[model samples]
Target: MNSYFVTATGTDIGKTFCTAGLLRANPTLSAIKPLLSGYEEEQAESSDSGQLLAAMGREATGANISAITPWRYKAPLSPDMAAAREGQSIDYAALLGFCRAELAKGPTLIEGAGGAAVPLTPTKLTVDWIADLGLPVLLVTGSYLGGISHCITTAEFLLRRHISIHAVLLNESPQAPVPEAQTQATLERYLPCRIFPVRRDAGAEDFRTLAL
Candidate 1:
């Protein structure tokens, strides 16, 4: 089965949205957010974990959500800081093992938290985790004012490390200075890869072109 590590330019930038769309389009595709920060059990249905559950046609119950996303933190911060707040730390080996096992189950979409540089532990950045997994990335970025620079910088960092980027999803951000098309064009110019524009409030059909 094919597996992809879904990462993004920053937190709340549409990694989950892009992933949910793909999952909805292909119902058989399994997925896991694996690690999450800023999770509240009371508002389970509104969180990213809940959204993913809905997309997968699973009930948004605590047990169901936890099955896919095990590492959850209540604080809205990077995993390193959030884990520190709870007097815990992520075991990199365990995290890698969990993802490998999940990927082996089927065509899984493994989603990540925060930005590429955001630390999962004291010394392990998100990029390091992606590198260790050795999976192609479904890179997601926003179409905000400084989107071009952020996309280019993150793209360069991954490409320099020889990470295969399966595709780039330019998720539309609200009240942006320019249209999403402009952002996609700029990224295409700098990045030698396929870039897809995901409009604001896009649905599952909007992402079918990716052939998920």
Candidate 2:
């Protein structure tokens, strides 16, 4: 099974959006946001798990969402802090095991909770979890002001840790402060990997050729 971890420069910068696009382009690939914070049961239809379920051609039911994202917290904080608020803690070993098991099923795309540096557990960053899993990453960032620096810094950090980067996807944002071409060119100059620009209104065909 082909699997890749999808992370972003920052939260709400289109990680889920880009993942959904990829799922639409390649329906055979299964996607999951293993751990999600700020998850409201009443708003399941619009949550990250809900969106991913819809992209995979499944109904965003409560049971389905729970199956995909087992560790969910109501607080809209980082996973660690969110879990702490509920007097709980993430079992890193178990979480890693779950991810490994899921990847064994088939082509899977595991979406991280936030930026690559976000804390998964007290001692583990999101990138650290990806490194432990030994899966290549698809770094998703926005085409906004300072985006180039954010993308490069995150990529460099991963490269320093010997994490294989599958690609850098620059998802165009509405009212983007910087032009998409400029952001793409800057990233291309510094990174050794391919960089893809996903338009603000990208369609399935737009992502059809992506080698995720």
Top candidate (lDDT) = 2
Name the best candidate (by TM-score).
Answer: 2
- lDDT against the true structure, each candidate: 0.89, 0.92
lDDT of 2 by residue, 1-212 (tens): 37999999999999998899999999889998889999999999999999999999999897899888999999999999999999999999999999999999999999999999999787999989999999999999988887888999999999999999989999997888778998899899999999999998898899887875
Q: Which runs of model 2 end up more than 4 angstroms from their true locations?
A: none
Q: Which residue segments of model 1 deviate by more than 4 Å? A: none
Candidate 1 has its poorest 10 consecutive residues by lDDT at 203-212
Q: What is the lDDT of residue 100 in candidate 2?
A: 91
TM-score for candidate 2, please give it.
0.98
Query: Which pairs clash inside model 2?
Result: none
